[model samples]
Target: MMSSCAHPLHGKSVETQHKTAATTSQQEKALADIAAETQTTQPAPVAQNPLLDGLPASDIAGVQADAKRIYSNHWGPVSERSRYVRARILPILKDMGAPRQLEVVPVAESGYNPYAFSPVGATGLWQVMPGTARMLGMNAAKGYDPRRHVEESTRGGVQYLQEMYAMFGNWPTAFAAYHRGPGNMTRRLAQHPWKPQDGLDTMPVPPVTMTYVRGILGLSALVQRGLWTFPEPWETHQVSIEGPIDVNQLAEAAQIDPEELYRFNPGLNHSQYLDSQIVLHVPESMLQPLLANAGQAAPEYVHAKVRKGDNLSVIARRYHTSVHDLKRINPDLSTLLQPGQTLLVPAGHMDSTSPPLNPLLAQGRRIHYRVRNGDNLWNIAKRFGTTPAAIARANSIKSDKTLHPGDRLWLLARARTS
Candidate 1:
C-alpha cells in the first residue's frame, strides 16, 4: 500500500469474487443442496492423512506440477515473506492443535502480507471479507480492524479452519470451504458424492477453490521435504500508545527510516498522528529502541486478487503499473484470469479513474458440438482440454442416454481466453 495509492477499501471482498466462489452450475448446486436427491454418505475429502489420503495419483501429479510451477517462479520472493512470519504463525497453529501443514493456507492466501487488501474488500492473511470477519468476532470497522493485526487475525482464521475441518471431516473440503465460503461448499457438496474411489481432486469444485486446496497441499509437501526455505525474516511489533502518535517522531524514536516505518505500519494511513491511542506495528528490532523513547516492526506487499474477467493488461493498467512488471512478479500467471488468484504489483500512485473490468463482455463464449459418429464424452473431453464428467455435468446428460452420429452434445460454457 503506497501513501499515494492506498485507497480505503469499503466492503466485503469475495475470494471465491466475481462474492465469487462459482462452481460449474451454481443453480444445480443450490438445487442439490436443498433437494433430497444429493448424496447422503460422502467419504471424507482427504482420508485419515491430510496429504496422502483421498487424492488420486493423477491429481497429485497435477498438484505437484502446479506446485513446482508456482514455486519455481514465486518461491524466491514469497519465501522471504513466508519465512518472516513463520515464527509468529507456527506457535499459533500449534497452540490451537492444528496441523503445521495448514499454516501454508495464509502463505497461499496473501503471501503472508498482513497489509494485503483485495479491491473486493477482503483483507488480512486469511483474505476474509468484512462480514465474515465481523461474524467471526473480529471488529472490522474503520480505525478498529483487528484483521490488520496478525495475531488476532491468525486466531480467527485458525478457529474458522478448525471448525471447517470438524464439519467436513477432512482437510481438502475444509480448505475448500475456507475459500469457497461454507455455504457455497455445502451447495457444491450436494452435487458431489463422497467418492473415495475417485479421490477428492475429482470433486467438481470451482476451479479456483480447487487450485487453492491443491496449492496448500503442494506447499505443505514441499516444506516437509526441506525444499522450501525462508531466511532473516523481519516482522512488525505493536505497541499501544496514549492518543495518536506522530509517525515521524515514532520512526525517529525507533531508529528507522520513515518509508520503512510506514511500510511496517499499514494501519497508519498517514505519516502524521490521527487515532486516539491506537496500537502501532513497528519492527521488532525497533521495539526496544522505540520503548526506550516510549515506542516498533513491518510487512506488506501490494497485490490484487484476480477477478473473473481480469487480464494482465487490464489489471496492470488499473494499478498504473505496466504488464511487464506484473508478469515479472507473476511469471506463472496464466493468460486467462481465474477468480481468487492473487497477483503482486507495485503499489505506486494508483489512478482512481480506471474503469472496472466487465465480466459481461467476457461471459462464456459459445462452442456448438454436433456429435459425430464414434465420438464419446471421453474423446470429446480430451479434444476440448476439459473432462468427460465436466461435459456430462454441463449438459445434464442422463446416464442411460447414449450419443450417436449427428446428435447434439454441447460443450460446457466457459470464459473466453482466446
Candidate 2:
C-alpha cells in the first residue's frame, strides 16, 4: 500500500518474512539461473532517462527518509512479483518512446499490481480512476478493464504523463499535475503563488500530492540504481493490427492462454467490448504462428478456382465465407460460374497453410505400415513428433492399445501446443 496518495492506507501494515539459509541460497541460484537463461541483453540507457526526466522530487525531510525506509521494507521479501511488474512495463515504455525510468510510476501508483483497487475508484497498476482511464483512451467497462492489462494501461499512463509534461513544461510539475488534477493545481497556484526560487512542495497543495510525486521519483531512482534488482526484459514480440481484431480466435490458433493474451492487450474493453483497435503482444516463439493464423482468420479473402461440378453452394462451402459474402465480393457469382474461372472467397481452413497439406499429410506419407517387432507408441510418437494418444485416436483405439507384429496402423502427426 502507498504511504500517501489517492488513498493513504495510513493505518494499514505490511508483512515481511526473514529468509532462512536455504531460501537465501535458492534465491541466489534462481537469480543466476535466470541471468543465464535470459535472451535479452540490458537495454542501452538513452541520453535522457525517463525515470529521472530530470525532475526534482520533494526534498522535504520526510520525503527522502520515508522513500528509503519504504524501499527497504516493502521489497524485503520475494522479488519475483517485482520482477513481473518491471518486465511488463519496460517494453511498453520503449514502444511508447517514453523513458524506461517512467516504469516505476505504476509501482508508486499501485505497486504495479494490476488488480489493485481503491475505494476511491482508482484501479490497476497506474491506479487511474475509471473516468480518467476512459478520458485517457482506456476501456474500463464491464469488468474487462484494459487498465488492468499491463501494456494497455502503460500506454494510457504514458499518454497521460505526456499530456502533463506538455502542459507543465517540467517533469516535477508534470508529476505533480498527474497526482493532483491540473485544475486543482491551477486553482492552488491562483490562491497562493510562489516565486520561481521556491520549490513546489512549498505551494498550497495537499501533502499527499507531494508524497505521491516524491514516491514515484524516489522509487524510479531505487529501481535504476540496482538497489532493487528488477528482472530481465521479457522475451516476447508484438504485432500491431491495422484495426481491432477477434483476439480470442487469434489466441486459440496460436495455442496461448487467452487470459495471458488479454494481459498483453488491456486496451480492449474489459467486458463485452466497446469497439476500438489495439496491438497484440505474444511470446516471441508464437509470433509467426499467431500472425499466420491472424492472416487466415482475417475477414479478407483470397482467390480460388472453381472446379467442375462446383455450384454456388459448393464453392461457398469450399471457402469458409458465407454465400452472401461470396456474392458481395464476387458479383454475379450466384448467377454464373465457369469450371476453370477464379473467384474471390474468404480463406478456407486448408488455405491457412501455404500448401493445403504438408509433406507429412501427402499420400505417400499416409500409406499405412504394419507394426514392426519391438515397436511401441513412444517410439512411434518420437519418430513422428506426435503423441501416442493422437495415433490411437486416429485408429479409434484405446490410449493403451497394444500393437502386434501384423497390426496395421496409421500415423498422424500432431502440432505441439505452446
Candidate 3:
C-alpha cells in the first residue's frame, strides 16, 4: 500500500511514531560518527561588505527590507525545513565547488521543502522544472520524478546552477538565468551586458528574477552574520539497496516504523516496492540493525582510479551503474575528478556496450587547464564557450582578477547556449 504518511517538516504534518530501542554500543558509536559528520558548526564569518557591488542606496535599502521580512515572518517554516536538509545539502554544494553561500538558494527557492510544487510545474526543494531535471540526468518519467528525491534533486539543481554560472559568468546573472530562462537572460544581457561596476540593479531582467537573486543573497547574509539560525540537523546516513524490496518488509528489517521510512524517502512514494537499486536515508542509530537484518550478502565494491578525462558519468557508465549510486557509496566524491584519485564503485563487470553519455552531460565535462601569460577569465571563457563568471567560480577566483601563468583552472568542455 502507498504510504499515507504526511511529511513531518510540513505544516500540520502527521508525526510517525517509531518504537524506541535501547542504544546498543555499536549503534552508539555509529551515532557518534554520524554526529561528527553531519552536525552543523558555527558558519564562517560573513564579509562586512554587501554581497553585490555598485548597488545604489535604494537597492541596498530594498535588500535589507527583504531580509528583515524573511527573518521576522518566515523564519519558523524556513528554519524547520532548512534544518532537516542543511546537513546533507551542504556537502553536495561543496562537492560541486560552489560557494557555501549558495546553500541558501533552496531556502529562497522553496524554503527547503522537498515537496514544494509550483503552479508552473516546478517541484522539489530547488523548485527545478521537469525539463531541466532531465537535462541534468534525472529520471523525470511519468509518475516517477527523482526531482522529489532530496539527494538526486540537489545534484541536479547544483548542476543547473553550475551550467547557468558557466553561461552568464557570474552568480547574479546565473541566479537570474535560473529564475528566468537562460535564453531570455542571454538576450537581455546581449542588449545590456553586465558591467561589474554597475551591479545587478542595472540588469534588464524581470523584477521577479531580480527579487529572487536579492532574496538569496539577503538570506545568505543573515545566516552568515548570526542574525538567523537553523535548528540542529537530523543525523542520517544513506544506505544503498541493490534490488526490489517491499516497503513493509524493508522497514521491519530495519526495525523502523513504515511511516518513518516513508517520511525519509519521498522519491519512493509512488510504489509499495522499490523495484530497482536505490539509496535510502536512515536514522544514524538504526544503521547497524538495518545492515544486520538486510538478509542479502554484503554489497561488493570495486575501486577505480580517476583518469585524466574521466568524470562520474563516464565511470558510472563503464561500471553499469548510475552516478547517484556511485555518489552514495563515495560520500566525498567531488564533481571535478582529479587524475590518480580513487573512487569506490558498485562491483560490476565493465560494459563495453554501455550507452552513450547523456548529451547534456557530455557538454558539461570539465578539464584542467593551466593559465598562460595574458590569459584572463574573459579570454578563457571565450575560448571554452563559457563565461568569465563561470571560469572564476570553478577556479574560486574573482572574474576580473589577473591570472598568473602556471595557475590552474577547471573549465567546462563546452557550455550549452540553450
* Model 1, span 1-418: residue lDDT tens: 1001111111121111001112236433532442232134332222222543444444544565567676567777676665445666677777776776666676677776655644333556666655566677764323434555556667778778777767776667777777767777788778875542355557668676666777877676555444555565565676776533455566666667765654454333333333245566666677776667643311112445777788988888777778887888888977878766676665453222211111221133345677767678766655443467767877888634678987776664321110
What lDDT does the true structure give each of the candidates? 0.56, 0.53, 0.60
Off by over 4 Å in 2: 1-64, 76-79, 85-88, 139-144, 194-197, 237-418
**What is the RMSD of candidate 2?**
21.2
For each candidate, what TM-score against the reference?
A: 0.54, 0.46, 0.54
Model 1 misplaced stretches (Cα beyond 4 Å) = 1-52, 56-58, 140-142, 195-197, 235-238, 262-275, 281-284, 295-418
Screening candidate 2 with a backbone cut-off below 3 angstroms (N, C-alpha, C), the clashing residue pairs are: 51-101, 144-270, 144-271, 145-270, 146-266
lDDT against true structure, model 1: 0.56
Candidate 3's displacement at residue 185, Å, is: 1.1
Error of 3 at 189 (Å): 2.3
| Candidate 1: C-alpha RMSD after superposition | 19.5
Q: 317 in model 2: Cα distance from truth in Å?
A: 27
* N/CA/C clash count, model 3: 1
